[model samples]
Target: GDDSFDEGSVSESESESEGGQAEEEKEEAEEALKEKEKPKEEEKEKPKDAAGLECKPRPLHKTCSLFMRNIAPNISRAEIISVSGDIGLRGRVGVNPRSFRFFRRGWVTFDRSVNIKEICWNLQNIRLRECELSPGVNRDLTRRVRNINGITQHKQIVRNDIKLAAKLIHTLDDRTQLWASEPGTPPVPTSLPSQNPILKNITDYLIEEVSAEEEELLGSSGGPPPEEPPKEGNPAEINVERDEKLIKVLDKLLLYLRIVHSLDYYNTCEYPNEDEMPNRCGIIHVRGPMPPNRISHGEVLEWQKTFEEKLTPLLSVRESLSEEEAQKMGRKDPEQEVEKFVTSNTQELGKDKWLCPLSGKKFKGPEFVRKHIFNKHAEKIEEVKKEVAFFNNFLTDAKRPALPEIKPAQPPGPAQILPPGLTPGLPYPHQTPQGLMPYGQPRPPILGYGAGAVRPAVPTGGPPYPHAPYGAGRGNYDAFRGQGGYPGKPRNRMVRGDPRAIVEYRDLDAPDDVDFF
Candidate 1:
């Protein structure tokens, strides 16, 4: 399928590729199959079986091609991985075109929905056992875990939930042995060193864990975990915390394994220095043993080219979130929402407050019906004053009995005389009394001719300020030009260039050539 055209995604061409197309095809087939199953067929096709044959469309247990007439669209290749124990693809072959649903010679659906992660995870780390629990889930979570101060400090969010399988095989689970998948045989032609490092670590880690469990059962120094009163920090919790750490290691280990399997060393050449670069990549120092050799630069570059061709498809998956899943996940989760808010051009204008129904107090968020039990209505600063005036006028118009008005009493009349022995203080004035004549600005007539007749000074023409904006200078560089302080002698305008200056003058008694017309 052409990965470029997403079902509900962007319109970019050549977007989705092979495996991705498979997933799209899956959705298409399912949709079509569903529509085809609608049973409103004519009763004529087969002398309607006495009891109508349930004319339901039979499901094709097999896969089909959704390849368009010209070419497929919106598909990315699917990852093919090896598994341990049972049900995974059984051959030494890689995934992508070879797997079952994707096996269609023509078309295939390659969606993020297909259970490759699960398949990949189980294949990488399987503990075959007879119990009912699935144990290979640790397969995919090798990377993508929280690492704080190199610590798994908090609960990692689970996705596509393998928690059941994780919980089932947990060290404490009694039913583990029943279904532990056997970590299959190491394949032939020498286990690639780069890929095997994590496998080696996992092998060692699992062995140690298994050994520790056994010793706890037998040794006097160690025994079954004791039940103690829960405290601020519990050992059991700490142990689980430690498991989270180990889980993180496992995740990294899985990624390392995939890298080893998917990549081919380049710098070392076609026949790599097996000792120097056994696999395409490895954790620097942690990568296994090394052997030295020399190869040509051209050979090294060619190797790089070959390696990238194989690895780009693989790295692309890890590098970018599959378009569909990124959109979908980003939509549903708040982190994605926050991420969008931070990274995308989503900007909020401002906050708005509304009155709370229960308390009648102002709040922010979604709006609520206004409620008022007490006389006051919770409102914004602007709206509060309006509400007060509104309520006051409303009561007055309602003809409701109002409180008495409070006003100052007037003074007694002259005929009434002094009712009491007390005299009144200074009386209030109807207007302000005039003060001494206001001072006027100092006279400017002394400097020139009178009130507003002063004229600007005559042409003592010069740079106004030595340090004025733009170019100004102190001393005169030329007879009439100011020293501009530019790199050389200043860039001053000569007197001749000054527009205000009279360049030439003629006298009435001068020679004919110089005389005025």
Candidate 2:
């Protein structure tokens, strides 16, 4: 009985333990289900919280940032942001940082998807106090902003050292004349002295060696030693100095050409190429061929003549001025003497009545005459002068006596007539006798009858029609009589007062006596 009771107790304990374990598993499943649902519930509430926090509704489409311009000077970036925020805009607002006084432009980037056109439309007519704001989309603003950042953050400065070096090299090349000849050719000495003293000195210094005594003297005196001077006699340094002197000479020559002779060096001569053969001056050496742009020898001579002509008058005037100054000082006033340099003509002529050669009209002054000529007859003045000179020469020639004319003696003979059958043929068939019809008048057709039938010619005083003047035609008798003296009918129908009959008859069947009027 004790063992059975113990077994019953064990069975009861096992059942109780199984029931407790199942209840604990059910609670854990319920807790896990609640925990899983909590996340979904929080997720659902999260959107609502976000919506409540947002100050403005989100847009449905992508928004474009805009570059606003023409903003009032008094408006600040914060005010712009506030104004945009009032219009439900949520975006970063940036004003041009470069603006110090008047903030006339800015950029706006939206945080949410919003239609750019709609934002612009709503922002239209936005005014800060009394100042209006202009807003529009500038697609290039992004690129400009990038550029501005780069400029502010990564600035760089470049130097043209290579260009300067190349220029220096070219300058040196222009001055150094390389005199090279064939392998077996003999060297010829040039007789012309060097034009540049600096170049001549450099060449002499390079060729002549320095003595030890001179070197010591220069070193003790703190002056440039002769041996050290040879260091500066490097070909590169010598070439540079020579080029500088040559450039100075060239500039002076060009200035003289322009100021004194009114000649353009570039226009007269082709620019020298560094590659061309060097110019040689000697009895045996010949000059290089003339460049394409070089002025001809004749043109150079003419220019020289004109230059001399212009210079003569100015020199004379300068000499006269100097002499006057000298006389005023009661001695030769060297310091007061006028320099004999010729400058450009800038002297205005006296205001005097000037006549136009073309129109023969008088002008108030030379200026007015010049203006009139330039405006009216500039193109034709040269042609007109040539024509006038030609006519004058022609008139002079016309005044001379004419030479007598010699006439050839005519052969005495009777006038030759063309044979009747040998007369020249007409281009077209002749419809009438040559002299019968006048030019431009149509020829009358000949009336054809039996052969040898003759048509009598009407008398000059007769009417044209045979039955005229008998009845209805009687009215025309007076007109015909007035035109041809009198009308006579055909021989077949004669009438009274007919010139063909040479008689006049009264109307016998009419009234016998005339009544007094």
Candidate 3:
């Protein structure tokens, strides 16, 4: 079926075919995605410029030497600063041309190897002050970028872009400030949020809500499993029941996929750009040349069977009459009408199975199955929601204990206290407690316990549990507490007036069975 599906998907593949230039795009991308798997012997390809000129592949450094070098030169230092500042505030990368083809100009090549699109995507709502510089500089930069390939470069690249972008943007920002400072006025500089991600976290809450709803739905109606892992046996099945289960899962998965497919359409703008099919893999591993192609009729039909299963459980799936009906009506595969039926009046899990705690139906996808469980099992899910909400509330109200207000630690007692003036953080020779000392070794405490305490026998060579000898140096413990002194109170855990934060421990009463997504 996968083979047949491959054949059917071929014609549709071209638009999806990494575009017409996919083969060309990756020849460039692979040079970037050189994992260790690539033979170490393979010579690294030289980078080129738009005019076929050998732009010395000087290290691609800073956040964006490429943008600054190509686009902002003609612009004033002040304006450049402002643009750089805006983008820096906006984030490391910003624009997204329709295709990876835009990277060749060297303004920015599509380093499929460099997945900056995620950063750019995250920056969509990222706001910045408009650069005072004229629009022509921006236009020039665009022209230069347009001259070469860009999008095709992305394949396996990730995080380094974030670090490099942050660093370069800061450098440019500082430079801009020095150049723009008024004759007598002092320059004010801004620093990045110590927190690497300046943006607020919103995904966890979204995912939580989605999971909860799916669980509720699944319990009410027997629905798909949360995950459809790879089945580990023969493809065509011998057991009819097992085959039916697999079919059910595939059907539900198709429904879920339909939602995803619709969301993927660019017109909807719901899909993340880099997530567009092959944008990542094609740019990374499948580079160099297209493998001519693969297609065949038998393969196509086998896949059609799979597609039928997927369509069967959908509420909005397409359909047509059966082959028998179609033939009667002068048509082929009239049974295609079944596609429409697949989506119509689907089974009701909620009305029939409200008594069960978990839905038994499953799909060939983990996500859909999980979604079903969360959406259909509301009562059971409430327990987990309450806990998460409690945790969330704690985060909101619990202040992080203040560092500056933390009081110096109280002098430690016995076992290993370092002598008073010992500077912190140095290791000291260990001196075990008297009772723990090797046989025959005896040390006396300098001072006796409490005035009224009984005079217990000393531990020099006494029996186990006997009081330590009078001269034993008990309070002089050390903690990597540098050279002969006590550590500076091992950094206080809690401080006073300094906006103190609290950390509440879990209540024993809380439920532990709630599944995490």
**If the candidates were sorted by their TM-score against the true structure, best first, what order would they fall in?**
2, 1, 3
User: How would you encode candidate 1's per-residue C-alpha lDDT over 64-130 as one tens digit per residue?
Assistant: 1122111112222232121222444422221123222333122222233346445544433432232
Q: What TM-score do all the candidates reach, one by one?
A: 0.15, 0.18, 0.14
Query: Which scores greater on TM-score, model 1 or model 2?
Result: 2
Candidate 3, residues 1-517, lDDT tens digits: the string is 9999888888678567567588778876786677653654343453334326555554433222223222222333344335445444322322333322332111222233343444344334433343222121112122211111121112211121122223332333343343345678764445423221322231221121247777778878886666846544554421211133322322332222224232211111223333322221111111122123333334444544543444322222223334454445443222333322222313335523322225557454444544565567545456555555544433333231224447688766574544675323321224323333333332222133232333223423233333334543334432212233222221122222233333334445655533222
lDDT (CA) per prediction: 0.32, 0.43, 0.34
Where does candidate 1 stray beyond 4 Å?
A: 1-195, 201-203, 207-227, 230-240, 260-517
Residue 78 deviation, candidate 3, in Å?
A: 27
Model 1: worst 10 consecutive residues (lDDT sum): 430-439
lDDT of 2 by residue, 406-496 (tens): 9798764454333354323211222221122222322112222221343223333222222223332233323222322222332222122
RMSD over all Cα atoms, model 1: 36.2
